[model samples]
Target: MLRFALFVLFGSVFAGCASIQPYYTPNPDIAANEVEDYEGPLDAELVAGTNIAQRIARREAADYAFIGSAAFTGAADEDWTSAMVRLGRTLKTEKIDYFTWYAGTDTATGMTSVPVMRTSFGTVWGPDGPRTVPVTMLDTDWLPYSYTVPRYEYRVLYYKKRKEPLPMGIRYEWPGEELGRRIGTRKALEITLVVPGRTGWKNDLFDGDVILAVNGRTPTKELMRQFCRAPAGGKLKIWRDGQIVEKTISADPSEGK
Candidate 1:
């Protein structure tokens, strides 16, 4: 609810004005994590009631989630086409996988118009010669006459989508260091076996544990070769026993200077 008023610039005169609420409002119902686009096609159905609660109940019974809803006042001047245009915009913007709409009749009361009068005096020449006359005029101002604004409230649209399945809680570790040959030092790799618990395997690798990076890289085949062939040592960041550890790698001894 708001009120408006106006004041004359550099003058003591002030005029009061009325502020009316808008006839339509857009109401959307959606959750942050529930947002997702439909894979196939989307559609809408215009239902014929205004009971939001009942509409919600029906949606729940059908295992649907709400997307959005809106109420429109069916003003005499607002035809079906215009109303549908607004509804279409809403439906498209909401992009709900499914839609249900409701419509009904109601009224709104408010000021429709305001009438103001203006007067002026002037001298005019007529058949009887020059004459002084006072002219009065009524200004057709549509700003302030208050009245009952009978607005027929109709159509309640419901938007919804299929309920999403709950995500599984299972978390599976990799179970083996299959890429160790490319991601680990050559000596460590030579002593290592991809299979768990190989006899005399000096290299260490546990389930879900592996060397992730070398010199801030993922240690791909090319990157590992470059790091190994370099003359200076580079840091090796490894994930072991639920923690990250750093080690230094010396230039490959076989790369004789």
Candidate 2:
């Protein structure tokens, strides 16, 4: 009688173990608002490409409207509102006229539809000890789980004027190492200096301006070379003083060397 009671007790515990369900925990940084659900399959490459394309398109359009667009990453300690305010102040300093912000959920919830089997207690045989066996049930299946993921947001800015050219006397450098770390790409070329009294255009740009993109695309070494060689003009989206300032560029005639 005692042996039978022990078997029943062990079986109950095993059943309980098999019935456990998976759970998810939300990240603190995620906002209360739940963003749109992704309808497609959970493919990392596809999702990343789509998001990147969307961001790039927005930046380009804004650059055409404002002469440039700047990008900012939210700090670990800052909330969304604080980040927006900080960016806004910088844009105001750069004399940016129109701007728009976009946000996306940093985490996605994943659930599984398939059921799975788990180890559970089985009946005891007279000759053998209590047996363990595989149990399959609806409740025993591993349920869906959720996790936090990092994503990118774009803050596109517009100038009061359109297609404004870069100030005449400025020279840009591809500050590969420093800017590469900030922008997450070594390909970033930033405008590091404005030569005093070199050109006729007003000196509106400041030092440490990062060239985010050219003609709505991230500048590559080959593209920069082409921009330098292009005769008529080229469009550029520059990050200046924490804001994106758009500018049109024409080959500098004075710097023939």
Candidate 1: 10-residue stretch with minimal lDDT:
165-174
Model 1, CA-based lDDT: 0.41
- lDDT string for model 1 (128-245, tens) is 9998888888877654343433355444343445334211100112223554434444222121112222211113333344556668775454455445445665676766655567
Off by over 4 Å in 1: 1-29, 38-49, 80-150, 163-257
Q: Tell me the tens digit of each residue's lDDT in model 2 across 87-178.
A: 33333322222222335446568976665555565665566766766654544454778876554443433222123323344445567776
User: Once all C-alphas are superposed, what RMSD does model 1 give against the true structure?
Assistant: 22.4
lDDT of each: 0.41, 0.43
Superposed by TM-score, candidate 1 places the C-alpha of residue 1 at a distance from the truth, in angstroms, of 36
CA lDDT, candidate 1, residue 11: 20
Error of 2 at 84 (Å): 53
